[model samples]
Structures are given as structure tokens and as C-alpha cells.
Target: MGSISDETVEENADAPTYVPSLPVPNVQELVKEDPLQVPDRYVRDQDDILQVNDMSWLSSEIPIIDLSLLSKGDKEELNKLDLACKEWGFFQVVNHGVAKKVLQDMKDATTEFFELPLEEKNKYAMPPDDIQGYGHAYVVSEDQTLDWSDALILVVYPAQYRKLKFWPSTPKGYKDIIEAYSKGVKDVGVELLRSFSTIMGMDQDALLGLHEELVQALRVNYYPECSRPDQVLGISPHSDTSTITILMQEHDKHGLQIKHNGGWVPVKPIPDALVVNVGDVIEILSNGKYKSIEHRAVTNESKERISYASFLVPRDDVEIEPLDHLVDSQSTQKMYKKVVYGEYLRSSMKRRMEGKAHTQMAKVET
Candidate 1:
């Protein structure tokens, strides 16, 4: 589908603005209540929660197959991997060859960056315009109330881009460590994309060529130890806007949740495994074959949680429309605008800052 510009709706002009309040409950008080009891506002029914717990049934359903096996050009295995990509946009990748030490260092560096004092964090807080740094939800505008979490965002692609311009100057080694991690993650992202291409029944070089100048970014999220973990969520439900997201989780923190068959499923972290999810772009490219799942994170009662997400997106110059090969007489082609990814990102940021609903914005024209 092509992108479409949003048509302004006057009815929303009178709606009350939502400003999020940080709920600070005493640790002792939280332990008294059910550690998993979400606040009334965030309370999801047992059925919904059970769906999350039912992930085991889908085990062997979603394989954490090794990509290294496919590099040998095994046609049968490659075909299976392709089916997995089309049917399940999510996968657990092991033996993809990212160094364990590097991954650990990346996690440590992220924690160190967020642990810096608030004032130091504020230096890199996203500007009202760019919306690319540490900040509370709805910092620029009030759409939905703020989510309970803090994040450090950096853009790292095209090889010649600037390092995060706004970051804490403390923790002397933070910058160097993060930069190294970013480079490593970028390399991994490229390799994974190549694998995805083969799975899509296309030559690896063909897909890489199409996305030669892809836009890649990293978001380091910190969910502070919450006294009332059940009262609030680390992040609200939303679909990622990139092509794919590769996530690394810190030890002992459980917060990532995924949506499957109309339910939220917790994605328990596996040591040394990177969590991968498809994004809107992939859904478009695959012509409804692969889904861009909706997922969110929930907080923990005692331990603080941290996660690193590497987003791989198309270059700003690339036109985002459904691939022609994905359409046929049996599948009607949907028309979206042929907008540039950069414009879409900028517009989306502006809409978010204005406290406007993301869905209200125009769809990307094909």
C-alpha cells in the first residue's frame, strides 16, 4: 500500500490533553499486594494474560534456527527458513555469530549510560523537534499519557553519520563503548537482512542493493525498578515502524511482550539469543505475507530492566510501497503514497510531539 497524508479532524480539537504522571510507590507497599497485579487502568483480563503464558504451545512452532546453516546453500533448509519468515515475522536467532563478549559489553554500556545522573541524561534529552533522545513520554505534546520508562536513542547508519549528539558526558568510557557496540550491531543487522532476502526467494545481493543506504538506529531503554510494577507498563502497545528490530536483553529482566492471535505473549529472554521482530516495512514488502506484530514491555516489581533495540529501516530516499512481485491477480494491489522514508519519519515525529494519535496521520503512499 502507498502512503496517504492525514486529513485533519476537527473533532479532536476539544479533547483533553493527557499528561503522564510518574507513579512512585514505596517498595514495601508493593510487596504487600500481588506483585503481578496490574493497576486497574492497566489490568488485562486473565484470558489475555493466559494467552501470553500459552507460548509454549507455539514452541517448535517458531524455530530459533541457525542462519549459519543456510550460508552453505542448502536449498531445503533455505526453503524452510523462507517459510518461517513469511509465516512468522518473529524469530530467535542463534549462532548468527555476534560475539558474546561484545553483546555483554553493549548491555553493560547501555546500563552505564542510563545510570548517569538525571542532569547528565537531560543533556541528550530529545529536542522538541528531533525527538531523538532521553525524555519522558509526551515531552513535546500530550496525546496519550506517558509510558513508564526512559530511553537513549541514537541514529547509526550510512557509515558517515554523526555519533549521538546529545549524550551524557559522564561515565568516561560510555561514548566509546556505545559507538563500538553500534558498529557491531549495524554489521549484524546487514547480515540478517541478507538472510531475510534469501528467505524471501530473492538473491541476497538484490535485496541489499535495494537497501544499500538503509537507515539504522539504536534505542537503549531503561525501565526503572518499580514499586508498583503492576500499576503501570514499561511501554504501551505499538508496532515498530522499521523493517526489522533486533533486541538484546539484560540478564534477569523480563518485560518484552508480543501480540499473537489477539493476545499479548511474554518473550522470555534466552541467554545469547537476539529477539527479532518484523516491522511495518516488511509487512508492506511481503504483501501481507509477513506480519508486523504489536508488542509492548511491562515493568518488574523489584529489579530494574534494560534492553537494546537495533532498528533497520530503509534510506530516507527510498520509496515505501508494496513490492510489485508480491501482488498478483489473486491479491489486489493496495495503493499508498510514494513518500520518502525521511519525510514519513519527520512527519511521524511531529505528529507524536503534537500529542496526536499516530493512526490519524496519513498512510505512507505507495
Candidate 2:
């Protein structure tokens, strides 16, 4: 764990107190009111909405990694994981230790919270200049194109960082489920990070040891069915700034897609499997040996889709850059500039989600 320092304090002070987003119509409520007529702001230009119907371009199914095997020190599974990160930047993990009961309870709680009366759900609405609570995120302008989704986003780790008031209480066991769920997913993330460090020929704990307080945030997204699904997006294409992100999709619904081979590949939801992806921070740390893939959510015409995404990030004070050993390799160079994690976050939260723009900001000009 990293020790506190004066530099950390200064960096935190400069970071925005809160990442605010513009208020957007409650997409769930709006769809209920008029599912057939999408607001002009919600409709994107034809060019903005990429057609993903060309299934032939999709590569083979996203690789699946067995956490159970990895935990047992199975070398073959470890190699598969390395290949998954390098080639696909995404994978599904089966037998991930998150309990089935915990997953179900949280999924139920999320659905119940979203089904609450609009007024009840709005009780925890995103405040005037804060991204926490419920509503759209990264909606920075009045004219900004809107996504057809609503989300409850909250920092769920390190105890003190959690905004309990924004946590849903309407669902009787919501808070407890969140606590249980976060702990389980965090365990999974830590194990994965350790495995990553091992893959890099470093001590298993080397990477995670950079921060005394790693941050874990949860975003529960509710994408309502849309009449014109082809014209709207559930979420814009973007790469996460986290070290890694884990997502639990509703078992029977499919909307997640990753950009591969210059085409969009749909991710089919598997029962009891959690999808994991490499984030920009991982790419930066690995000196681009691993990649962070661009992915987006598409709106569904016949049914609503819900997903739970847990982002695991380094604490604000940690300095992030290509690890020395990775850069020292003959074939590699320092591709990204070193920056405090908090400052990187500040830059990311300031911009709307688009492709991999935020990650590119860290690249060094050779």
C-alpha cells in the first residue's frame, strides 16, 4: 500500500469536488410516456449510430476464463487469460467466486429499485452538480446527444467514499445486497489483478500494492425498450479508465458489444458468467502489451436490459504510467505520460463518453 504524501493532498485538492452532469429526462419514464416518439436529443445522426447487423464481421465468441482454474494455479488457464487480455481485451469468467445468491439478490434489488414509482426513485436523484445518485451521466450539454438509459452510480468501496444517501432504501435489502455484492466482486478483481501481475513476471501483489485505497465504483444501468432501437444508443462507445471492469448482465438479455477487427461483436450473455474487460489503465501499465477495447451498449426494441458494472480503479494519489520493467523491454517504449490517478480521472470525468478519447490524452508524443 502506498503511503500518504503531500503530493497526494495537492493532487486531490485540484481534482473536481464532484463530476457534474446535465439533467436529462428520466428515460424509463419518458419511454413509458411515449415509446414511439424519441425526442430529438435522444435521436442520433445516422453516422453516429453504427449499424451492427453485419454478424459476419464478428470474430469468434469472446474468450471465457475460469477463475476457479486460475486460483488452482493451472498454467494452461493462466496462458488463456494472457491471450484473452492481449487479443480480445475482454472475456467471460465462469466459476468466479461471487456467490450465486449474492448475484441474484443484487440483481433483484436493482430491478426492484428501477421499478419503484418515479417519485420514489427520484428521491435519490443525481444532485445539481454531482454524478452520484440516479439519472444520466456525462450529459454535459443541453444539446448533447442523449442515451436511452438511466443509471444509479455510486462509489462502493473504502467505506468512507460511499454516498449512502444515494443508495436505494426503497428495496428492503438493497444496501445490504450492495455491500455483499461489492465485496464479492472486489475479491474477484483483486485476484485477477494479482494474476495480471504474475503474467507480467512481477510479484503477484506488485500492481495492487501501488494504492493504499483502491476505489471501486458501481453503475447499475437500466435501458428501457425503444421503438426505434436502431436510431438510439444505450450507451456511447468508450473505454473505461479503470484498471479493470467487471459486468454482470441480465442472464437472458443481450446488448453489450465490443469493437473487434474494426467491427462490432455482440456479447451473448451466459448464465452465471461475469464479463470482464481490460481498461485503459491496464494498457498503460502494461506498456500496450495488453489492450483496452472499445465497447458500447445498444438499445433493445423488444425488452429492457439491465447491467451491473463494477469499475476497479487505483486511488487518487497513485502515480500511473508504464511500469519500468515493461518499458525496459527491448520492444517497448514509454507510450503514456505519467500522471496522478486522480488527475487522470478529473480529465476523464470532464469529457463525455466517446470512443477512447480519454485514454488518448495520456499518450506521449514521440
Candidate 3:
């Protein structure tokens, strides 16, 4: 774990000393008030159904890779990455060369942003129509009663137009710092995609070519200390919708969990390491060669948690379907349609807002 510095101090001196105690709304009341109506799907018993301790069977072999030691051009490292992608769908990367200071700065800035007073933070609050912002859960209704968390979701892509209008003005240097970090993460993502291409037995540039104009976003999530950590979840079980997600976690706080084999396993944090995972788009493009694993976040009774997830999505105009080379007369290659990335993203957002399970892609014409 990385050493804690003074930057971890709470940004808002006048902010609530603790998460406010709000009454948990009933399911019917939640549905009536929330536009997302997420709580409607889950049974709202006071029982701690979300808690699970039988994680012994969970995969303990999360791959820890050292990119600097591996030959970037070597076929062996690429092969190893590919195998990890197919089997684990998640891995920890070290020595990937994004400065440790930059990562820490981003984390510090995020914690400070979320610490802002409710009124000040609300200035950049997500619009009722947009499901991204400084709130507990945008897609769900306030009455739905989420466990406990606040997040800042930033959309930085197309370098032109964004489909969803969710951007927050922050402290003086916040934007510049975050944008630089985003660009750095994007470059790393490109490198990983190139490695994936090699593993798929395609030209190194093939995947990069297809993603020349990828749309990317950063989700800065903060899960505050919960009064009833065992009774609820920080984030419900779900799979990511992007091609891939690279996450930087706070030291000492253990909130991230992943479903592997059959149980949930805590992903212990490693200082300066980036947690990389496959997403739904990669599963489709790889024709199921790579799976998108289900994961969730859990709250702690005492310690607050923070995480930064950089999602690499395909450009709105990119055609999403299995690669031609992966298909053959003997292979069942026609599983999904050639839909535009933008359409797929919109559909995913709607499903998420509804608090439904992630939707699988179906074969259909654009």
C-alpha cells in the first residue's frame, strides 16, 4: 500500500462530519420518486443478503504483471496478456510507467472534490436527464436509498462532441490535472489494445486502427463509511459496458470485489499498480474469447474509500461486431449485429438507469 500523505485531508471543513442518516425508503415509494427506479428490482429486506464470506474458493491468482520487465515487442508477453484476458479477465499491472505522483494527485483531487459541501458540489450536479455526476447514483431515484457513495463522472472523448452532457468544473487546477491523467491513461490503453491485437493473431495496428477515435471517460468514485456495511453494497453486481477499464485504487481501503469462478473475491490494492479488466465490448469483438467478469463494490464500517476508473469505449461511429478473421464456416460468428458504438452505449445507459442487469448484444442491423 502507498503511504498516506496530507493530501488525504478532507477538502470541505464544513461538510457533514459523517454521512447523514436518511430513512431508507420503501420500494414502492422509491419507484414513485426515482426516475431510474433501481430499488424496484431488488428485494428491500433489512437482512444482509449482500454479505458473503465464502470467498475461499475465489481465484487468488490475479495476475501481477511487470510491463517494464516484459519485452513489449516480444510475442511471449503478448501471449501471456492474451491468456490472462481469456481466463481471468482481470490483472494488475506494475511498472507500466505512469508516474506515481500523477496517480496520487488524481486520487487526492477526487477525494477533495467529493468532500465539497452538498450545495457547492450540487452546482456541478448531474442534470435530471443525465446519469453522471456528484450524487449517490444518478440512474436510481433519491428515494431508492443507495448504500452510501458520491462520485464525479467525467466524459472526455470525441475531442469534439459528447452524447451525454455531464462535465463538472472543479478547483483551479482540477481540469488540467484530470485531462492530463486521462490522456496518459488513454495512451496506456492503446498499448494494451495493441497487445490484445497480437494475442488475437491480428496485426499490431489492427485494433488501434479500429479504435482511432475511441470515446473514453473517467469515473471518480468515493464510497463513504457506511453505518450498515453488511446490509448493502457500494455498487451492485454488474459488468462494465466499455471495451476495458483501468483502475487506480486507494491504498489500505479494500472495497473492490470481483466475481470469479463462483464467489466474490477482494482485490487487494497494490501501490502504483493499475487494475486492468476486460469489458463487454472486448467480449463481443473477441467472439467470447475474452469474458467480461462481474464485479461489485462493498462498503466498510469505518474507513472511507475512493477509486478512479478509466473506461475506454469505442468511438460512436465504430461498427461493433465479431472480427471477420475470427469467424469461419465451422465457427458461429454471427452472434451480434453491426451496431454503432453510440447506440450500444445509449442502450446500456438506459438499462443501467433502470437498474437491470447488463444487456447482451444481439445480432441486428444498424
User: What TM-score fits each model?
Assistant: 0.78, 0.93, 0.80
Q: Quote model 2's TM-score.
A: 0.93
What is the lDDT for 112 in model 3? Answer: 71
The candidate maximizing lDDT is 2
User: For candidate 3, lDDT tens digit of each residue in 234-326?
Assistant: 776677878899998887888888877666778888888899999878877877788888888887766678889999987766887888877
Q: Highest TM-score among the candidates is held by which one? A: 2
Winner on TM-score between 1 and 2 is 2
Please give the range of 10 consecutive residues that has the lowest summed lDDT in model 2. Answer: 3-12
Model 1 C-alpha lDDT per residue in residues 1-366, reported as the tens digit of each score: 211112221323322112232323322223335544434434444443344443535534565757577656667767766666666667777776777878887777667766665666677766544435566433434334345567777665653443345544456656656666767667767777777777666788656677657677778777766666555667766767778888888756779877666556667677888888887677667666776777778877677788889889887667766667766757566544345666655555443222123423334435
Per-model lDDT? 0.62, 0.85, 0.66
Error of model 2, residue 47, in angstroms: 1.9
TM-score attained by model 1? 0.78
Query: For residue 94, what is the lDDT in candidate 1?
Result: 73
Q: State the lDDT at 222 in candidate 3.
A: 72
